[model samples]
Target: MTTKLDGNCLALDTVSLSRRNKLILDRISCQLYPGEVLGILGANGAGKSTLLNVLSGELPADAGRVLLDGVVIHDMSVGELARRRTVLPQQAGLAFNLAVREVVAMGAYPFPELSARDVASAIKAALQCAEVAHLAERRYPELSGGEQQRVQFARVLVQALIARNPGEARYLLLDEPTASLDPRHQHGLLGAAAMLAKQEQLGVAVVLHDVNLAATYCNRIVLLAAGQLVAQGIPAEVLQSGYLRQTYQLDSQVIAHPQHPERPLVLFA
Candidate 1:
């Protein structure tokens, strides 16, 4: 599978950030390969979401650099960044009442400016991929929490792939992507992302709460606790009970899964 990214590439170089004198990240450095899934795992305030924001270009790094491939991400204008990256924040907002199709169409607003024909086709594709095409005309605010989240996913997918190219790399950042999803759809979307990364060769990073889900879908998992890298590597190496207890302050157990070998169950300790 192709793993090369467009322009230089995406990387974090000793990046640090703070808010109101509170340090959120402490010189964290990491790289993501093409067709690789990187899971940022941490507790509620462990800086998982902040790291995602820094990588996604939504928030600036306070004392370090973020490079896209080889180009410093800070150098790119917002429009330029839009051409290469997509981030699905914890809650994508909706001020104006809009239909699902209209919401999905907003993703295309950044590129090539999808025409009426293009919007219709692209929205259809995104909805189908997100399994919400049947609810295309439904109002966004009126949908169930899970359905709205799916619709948001549709929008995010549309934005990321509207003008995709094999020559140019694309990065997808999701914050707790399955937070509102039911068990089944949660599995579906995470499964879909893994396939997209390993099979279709997309670079993906997501903040996840469920250790089993991350182990199953991600190629590598990075753990943070109080703004430090406590663990990172293949699932087996990084998912020990001691690590879980220390990082999340929770009693949990890990065991191999019957269906997915790489992913394991996070049993109650």
Candidate 2:
């Protein structure tokens, strides 16, 4: 990744983290640019989520810095950060049985300036983007796991859209968002993420366990192993057989997707 300073990029500058005497992340450095999807790929316990939490300012980097648009993220106020970025965790808990629209409406809390009509419009647009418009009135708790995940996607989309600042780009951080979805919905969710990066000029960083999904949707890929950055580059540069074997400890074949030659397809043994 390029280290050139840009006011439009979210970056990690040799960031490291530790917990209970264990190093969870070790000097990971990368940049997420506006209008691009950067994918984080790793096996279990590779510290993908820890890296994301640090980027989102949910957890501080013990050694280095996490920057948003040339400003240190930790120095920014919570409201300021919330207005510019939204995170969707691996699992989100809702204590009450809120309707889908109500859950999405919670994203508007950061912007008290929005009128009721404006919030409603934002929610509707988010629902349509997430393909959950028909579920707007449905009870969130009663929906299937996949449906609930899509609803959460809508909520974050609303958060990203309504709080956007002019002359600045927003960001979306998603952790394992496709873990609960079927094959089709997995593509839908990631497709929407890619669309957001391209059409809305939002910087997106997503943690994905599935390498193929990352390759299909991401503009760049970061491979992590044992809390360190194994490789960071375009998918074709990083998803080779050697890197896959080192990261996953498996033999695999990497090939170009016939339909989309720029995208690599992995066949694991």
lDDT of each: 0.82, 0.91
Cα lDDT of model 2 by residue, 56-152, tens digit: 9989899988889899998899998999989999878777889999998988988999899999999999999888999999999898889899999
Where does candidate 1 stray beyond 4 Å? 1-8, 113-115
Residue-level lDDT for 36 in candidate 2 = 96
Estimate the TM-score for candidate 2.
Answer: 0.97
Q: For model 1, what is the alpha-carbon lDDT of residue 79?
A: 93
Q: C-alpha displacement of 254 in model 1, angstroms?
A: 2.3
lDDT of 1 by residue, 131-168 (tens): 99899988888888889888888888887777677666
Runs in model 2 deviating more than 4 A are: none
lDDT for 98 in candidate 2 is 92
Model 1 lDDT-worst window of ten: 1-10
TM-score of 1: 0.92
